[model samples]
Target chain A: MELHDKIRILADAAKYDVSCSSSGSNRENKNGGIGNASFYGICHSWSDDGRCISLLKILFTNVCIYDCSYCVNRCSNDIERALFTPDELADLTINFYRRNYIEGLFLSSAVYKSPDYTMELLIRTVKKLREDYNFNGYIHLKAIPGADINLIRLAGLYADRMSVNIELPSEKSLKLLAPQKTKESIIKPMSFIHSKLLEKSESKKLMRHTDKFVPAGQTTQLIIGATPESDRTILKLSENLYKYYDLKRVYYSAYIPVFNGNNLLGVSSPPLLREHRLYQADWLLRYYNFKADELLTEEELNFDVLLDPKINWAMKNLNLFPVEVNTADYNMLLRVPGIGLRTAKRIVKARKAANLNYDSLKKLGVVLKRAKYFITCNGKYYGGCEIETNKIKNKLLPKSNVLEGQLSIFDSIYKTESNLPILV
Target chain B: MVNYIFDGTFDGLMTVIYVSYYNRQIPNDILSENSYQKNFLGDDIYISTDINKSDKVQNAITTKISKEALKNIYYVYLSELESSYMLIYKYVRLGFKIGRKINYFLQNDIVNDVIKLSQRINHEAYKMIELIRFKEIKKGLFYAKIHPDYNVLPLIVPHFAERFQDQYFVIHDVKRNLSAVYDKKSWIITDIPPEITLITKEEEDFENLWKIYYKSISIEERKNLRLQRQHMPKKYWDMLTEKQ
Candidate 1:
């Protein structure tokens, strides 16, 4: 088959992975090397679904042995199959990088023939790209489950990032969907990469120049809505993975049903809004110093689709609101729904010079429409209405999902003369 | 109210700040020489581009504030906003008064405005570095065109130069009629005359392949054109290979 045909089939097979971020490590071009990695990864293009495309994400082959129900390339599924030789893959990556088509390569594959064989082909392809081609660009390689530990470690040295996807969140789902694969087969490689990364960092302190092992660190993806796992369960697992493994990121790929025949899958895919809410809650867990238990409960299986997780949390904890912004600590300021990390830092710095009023807070990039109810400036409450839950909810909810131009209760009462664009 | 007119250059902007501080009066407005507004009421001063005076002001910023702040001020000048000159003038005056402590005053409108302008410029430059698509026009020569919201051609070339060190490429900012030409050894920014067309036979083939791959990778079940446009705005649509 032609190379273009292979790219279409292989790229189509690989699109479901959805972990195309090429960031978190900085590698300069060597004297003879052709490319480098920036700390802030660049999005080369946006795919139609709005996800950033940072790498040439493709699978080595779409042919598979295991019959995972959620997978597009399962053995039972009939899809066009193609494979790229190590040389063709390496050359395609270099050619694309030269034309500035991608930051690097995201190489994944189904278990073609066997796990070990598929992993061997992947290793050969990446090793050729790095050593033979003198390619110094970012390479995110997948660690095939049940592959040799030595092979995983060796691939880590050449790749900038590595991931062993826990495709299903729980062991029960792994058993139900993919009987051939066990949870241990997936997690063993993850622990191996985690230990190797730890060793590399420790050795770097002692020795001036130690070989880099997955310099951008590791990440994994979990398929949401495929199985009947609650949001609380998913987030709890993610928090543990972050705390224990020191993983860089845990991506949540919303399940898109490919095979219609299976009774095990849903008739229609889950709402994208659910996926978006999970991302917001995940951000709070990662950056805003919120714990999993704080944000979730057994009664509330999932986040409210209408309200964001931060606002939901704030509304639940109203006593925390009406906190004086002039005297609030950085943590307290961060908890306000509208103040981001940048705005909180700005408020901290600006408040030292002058006591910030509502106008000053807006100038500092705070979303005053949401923040005014929660905060007080200089012992004065600018929020007109008494603190009430349903009233605040009515004020914050979009007039309709179609258009976000809903006038809040405050907007109806007072209108500003200046027509400066609101950042929010 | 005093009005200061300056050449559209960073050095000229710095010279205006130096002259304003030396004269000991806050100008009501600073206008670029190219601006259309003619005001007969205020005293209008045409400030010549003085390198020595500009250098003195630049040095004071480095000593009083920081090198990073000076670099940001330069980026703000690249914004080409009409009010940027006066805003920057007011900002530097405050910087000199507060010395190094001026960095902490985020509440001040002048300080915050300068920071916001630089952020806007930097964001556009970063987006251009990602969205730029180079087509192979000759054996070893590649070319791409863009129309970024900010004048970010000066900022993007260094990144592309370092990334594609052994090749020659030209990145044209079509809106500004400016192009950064990069040879294997070095790069130089130059003006491109009208009626220049850059195309190649093989370029179409590559573009078709890229568009195919772009389409194939997107999940049909999760198509969100609005979200796509939010990240890759409509203004940059024409220059993109896939979009074209």
Candidate 2:
């Protein structure tokens, strides 16, 4: 096949694996290297789907031996197939990096011949990019499940970040939809990378110069709504991943029904809003110090479609409302729906100088539309209405069908602030 | 009422702050020569750019206040907003009085305005870092053209210079008619002709491939042009290779 045709096929096949971040790596350029990784990732462009195009995200090949029912690249599906030569992929990455078109390569592939063989191909491509081309840009490699431990270790040395897609949320879903993949196969590699990263850090502390092994750490993706896994279950799993495996991020991809199979959910559209809620919940878990159980309970299996996860949590715990912005701790300020990390920090800093009021909070970038309901400045409430749970819920709900429109990937204010470098 | 006019340089602005400080006279407004309007009521004082005075002011800011404050002041200057000069003046004066605590005085209108303007400039600079796309102009020379709302050429050049160390590239800010030229080792901001076209044959091939890659990567099932426009604003679409 032609090169353009190969790129089209492979890139289209890879778009389903939605781990597009290029941040958290600070790989410096070597003396004669062609590129370097930014500690805070740079987005080269935004795709028509509203996702940030940070890396040259493409599969090394679209040929798969596994027959995952939900995947577009299932062996049963009769789609175009293409494989890139190691040199071809490396040259493309270097050229694209030179033009400032991408941060680096995000090389993922289907299980072509075998897990180990496919893993070897990925290693060779990154090896050529790093050794031959002397490229020091950020690389995110997909660690093929059930690949050799040694091979995975070697790949981690070159990749800034590596991931093994959990594929589905539940073990039953994996068995039903992707019979070829097992829970053990995915978790084993993830655990191995986690251990190796721990060892790398330990060595770096003792020795001044230790070979970087996944310097940006590992991340994983879970396919949401494909199985009967509730938002609570998904978030709980993410919490465990962050705790146990020390994963940098757990990406939730809304299932886009590509193949008509009885095993998959027959959804008309991707569960984007649910995925969005999961991200918000994830942010709260990571930055806002909220636990998964705190965000959702066993009674409420799913997030409220009308409100954000934070707002929903706030409404449930309305007894905690009207936290004094001037006297509230930083953590309390963060719980307010519209008070983001930046704004919360700003409030904490600004309040030290003077007692804050509603007007000052607005100038400090606090989204007063929502925060007014939860905060009191100088012992005065500005929510206009009494803090009744149902009334507040009715008031806070979207006035229009705003959720019908496709949501921007970075719609969450916290997500954008997290992307910015932490202010000094 | 008196208006202070400077030569529109960062140093000149600093000098205006210095002159106002020593004289202990608050100007009704501070304006760059380009932005200055003749008002019958206010007397105009042209403050010439002085290196010594500006350096003294800069040193004082760095020493008395935090380095973070100086950085904010510089970013606010780069914004070139009409009120940026007065905002900086008020901010610096407050910084001198409160030391490093000026940043925490977010309730103060002058401090708040200065911080917001600086953040705006920094945001644009970071956006430029993301949106810059270079095309191979010559055999080994790459060129990119941008028209950012703020003067972010200086802020973004260091990033490209560090990332693409071995490659020669020029990022031209078309609105300002300035280019940041990097030649393997170092980079410098220089003036460039407004209408310089340097597209090579190979550059066209790569551009086509990139456009194809961009198109293929977007899932047709999740097409969201509204969200796309929100993230990558329509104003920047003209210079983007894929959009073109």
Candidate 3:
């Protein structure tokens, strides 16, 4: 096949993974290296589907031996397959990186010959990029499940970030949809990467010039709405992944049905709103210091479609409402419905100079429409009505379609308004 | 009332501060020569650029207030807003009064405006770092063109120079008619022609491949042009290869 045809096929197959972040690595350029990684990631372009194209996201090859029903590259599917030579892939990465088309490469693959063989191919490709080309840009590698622990370790040394996708949320879903894969196969490599990352950090404290091993850390993805797992279950699993594995990010890809055959549930469209809510709750868990239980309960299996996860939580716990912004602790400020991390920090810092009134809160970038229902600036309540749950819920609920102005999935996941454009 | 007119350089602005402070005159407004309007009411004083006076003012700001305050002042000056000059004058004067605590006074309109303008410049500079795309012009020479809202060419070139130290590249800010050229050893910002188009056959081939890859990567199931435009605004679309 032609090179362009191969890229089209491989990139299309790889788009479903949805882990395009090029962040969390600070790899410096060597004396003669071609590129360097920034502390925070840079997005090169946004795709037509509103996703940031940060890396050259593509599969080394689309050929697979496993017959996972939900995947487009399943063995049973009669799809065109292409494999890239190690040198060909590395050359493409260098050419693209030089032309500033991408930050680096995000190489994943289906189980082509064997897990170990495929993993070896990935290692050779990155090795060629790093050693032959002296490329020090960001690289995100996918650790093939069931690959040898030693091989995974070697790949981690080359990659800035490595991920092992836990596609299904539960073991039961994995067995039903991807019969060939086992839970142990996925978790073992993740646990191995986690420990290696910890060891790297510990050794770096003792000595400054240790070889970097996955310096950007690891992230995983879970396919949502495919296997009847509720939002509560998905969030709980993510919280555990963060707490136990010390993972940097857990991506939730709303399941898009690739095969319309038996066993897999049929959906007309991707569960994007549910995915958006899950991401919102994920942000609360990661940055806002809210536990999964605090965001949802056993009785509430799914997020309310009308309101965001944070507003929902705030309405439920009305006793915490009307907290004085002037005197509220930083943690309490974060818990307010409309107060984001940047605004909360700004309030904390600004209040040290003088008391902040409602007008000043607006200038600090607080979303007053929602925060008024929860916070009081200087002992004066601005929430016109009483702090009743239903009244606040009615005010906060979306007047239009909830999905009309929804944020792009990746952009809204983090509270950093670093990407927001300034209006001239 | 006196209106201070400067030569539109950071040094000139600093000299304006120096002259105004030594003369003990509170100007009605501070304007760059390019943006100054003749008003019959206020006396307009054209302040020439003086390195010695500017250095003293800069040193005083660094010693009395903070280095961060000086950075904020520079960024606000780069913003080129008509009010930015006066805003910085008030901000620096206030910074001298409260030491480093001036930045924390977000409620004060002058300090708040200065911070916001500086943040805007920083934001645009960061965006340029992300959105600038280079095309291989000749075998080893790469070129990119951008028209950012703020004068962010100087702010963003250091990043590219560091990342592509061994390669030859030019980043042109078309709106300002300036280009930063790096020739494998060092980089310099200089004037460029208003129109320059240089492309190679190989560059076109790679651009086509990138356009193809960009299209293939977007999920058809979730296509939100609004969100795409929100993140990557339409004003920047002309320079983006894939968008074109």
Candidate 4:
């Protein structure tokens, strides 16, 4: 097949992987190559489905001997199968790159013959992009689960970021859903790569010289609403991975029901709303200072279908809030139902200038309908219809799936930091 | 009995603040050429375009507010705001009176709005790295250009410097002829007359390659044009390496 034909087929197959942030790397362009990875931040792109497409997300090949039940490209599926040689992919990347189509390449694969064969093809493609083409753009290589550690490490040097997906949360789930893969194959490489990143970080600390080692750090993905894994199990596992491996991100792909036959997941798609709630909860865990135990339990397999995670937490722990804004610490402010990072900082900064009243707080970006019930504005109550809980329920809309306005070309061209546009 | 007028520069803004501190309750307005038309006849209107007065006002801010607040004040002034934006100037000045013990103003919508403006400028400049696609010119210099909303041409420099450490490159904020040039080791912001800069045949060569790549990578099944444009807008195509 022509190279263009291969890219069309392979990019479609590869789009599902979803980890394309070219962030956290600080590599610069060398003698003849173009592009570099800056450490401060990287550009991120989101598909209409809201998945980030910051890199040239593609697969080397979709041909698989090992059929993971959740995978769309599994062997039994009649979807087009394609593969790109190392040289062809590099050509396409450089071509797209010079055109300004994508930031870099995000190459993943199904087991093309075997783990080793697939791993070698991936490594060769990256090596060619770096060596033959001298292309220095961001390359996120997906580490095949059963690929040799040696192959993984070599590919690691050429790529800015690498990931080995621990697709199922547990070994039991892996056996039940993706029989061809095992926990050891996944964790062993994850552990190896995680340690190397740690080793590089420690060396840089001692040496005070910047050397590269997976500078974008490592990230992994988990398919939610697949098999029997509960929200409690998923988040607990996510927390452990972050704490243990020092992972940069743990992406939760809401299971899209596109598979059939003995494939594990049930129904058409994972509740996207539930997945969205989990992301908000995940944000709380990573940045907002919430813990796993604070949000979920074994019985609750998913977040409340009606209310968001934070709102549910606030109503359940009603005794904690009505906290004064003037005195509440950053943690307490972050815990407020309607408050986000920008708003929390605003509350902290503005409190320095004047006493916060209900009006002032409203101006600061707190969602008063929800936050008002839980907070006191200068020791005065505002929320709740009659100081009776259920009466206030009518006021706060539960889980409003605010369909975001379509991101216009102009908006993306000049998008500001808040992830919102001034014109919009 | 006087209203002070300034040239709309940050320094000009500070001069007004300096005079206001000395002469309380002065019915004054800060006006830029972009907004100001006629001057009032009766009141003593002092055009304090003097750099020294601007200095005095700025020094007072540093003393009254933290150095951080002074920076905020300067940035808000950079908003290139209309004359009615005086409310922000007053709000920011009030911010100093409250000091570090008073973070409540961070939540003040006016203060937040200005901060967001500075942040947007910074963010747009930074994003030009990933989003500002470049073409290899015939002269062999890798060149990319952008027309971002804020003054991001300055903001995107250190990034291109650290990453493309040993390459010859130019990232021009085409809106302003200011371009960032990296010559192997360091970078310099240079003024270029973009209207006159000749784009050569190599751009055509690279342009065709980029289009082929752009078309090849897109999958029709997930071809969400709205989403594609959401991340890479069409207006940018006028300057992109691959828009055709």
Q: Rate the local accuracy (lDDT) of all candidates.
A: 0.81, 0.84, 0.86, 0.68
Instruction: Report the C-alpha displacement of residue A79, candidate 4, in angstroms.
Output: 4.0
lDDT of 2 by residue, A1-424 (tens): 8889999899998888888888889899988678888877778887877777889999999899988888888898888899999989999998888887899999999988999999999999999999988999999999999899999999998999999999888999899988989999999999999988888788888999988888998999988888898999999999999999999999888887766655455676677767777877888898889999998998999987667788889988999888988899999988888888778888889888888877888898777777888988899999989998887777766454323211222342212211211111
Clashing pairs in 2: none
**How much TM-score does chain B earn in each model?**
0.93, 0.95, 0.95, 0.71
Worst 10 residues of 3 chain A by lDDT: A415-424
- Who is ahead in TM-score, 3 or 4? 3
> How far out, in Å, is residue A164 in model 3?
0.3
| Model 2: residues with Cα > 4 Å off, grouped in runs | A261-263, A398-424, B35-42, B192-198
| Model 2 interface Cα RMSD in Å | 2.9
Q: Estimate each model's TM-score.
A: 0.92, 0.95, 0.96, 0.80
Model 4 chain A: lowest-lDDT 10 consecutive positions: A415-424
Q: For candidate 3, write residues B217-238 as lDDT tens digits.
A: 9987677677678778889888
lDDT of 4 by residue, B1-244 (tens): 4455567656777766666666665455656654566655646454556799877766766676666666655555544556334755665566666655433455556566656665655555555655676666636467777887655565567766655554567888777678888787788888864232466775665456444544544433333455456565666556654444
Taking the tens digit of each residue's C-alpha lDDT, what string does model 3 give over A78-182?
Answer: 888998899889998988888778999999999999999999999999999999888999999999999999999999989999999999999999999888999
Better of 1 and 3 by DockQ: 3
Query: Which residue ranges in model 3 land beyond 4 Å of their true spot?
Result: A401-424, B37-41, B192-198
Flag the better candidate by TM-score, 1 or 4.
Answer: 1
TM-scores of the first chain across all predictions?
0.93, 0.94, 0.95, 0.89
Name the docking class for model 4. Answer: acceptable
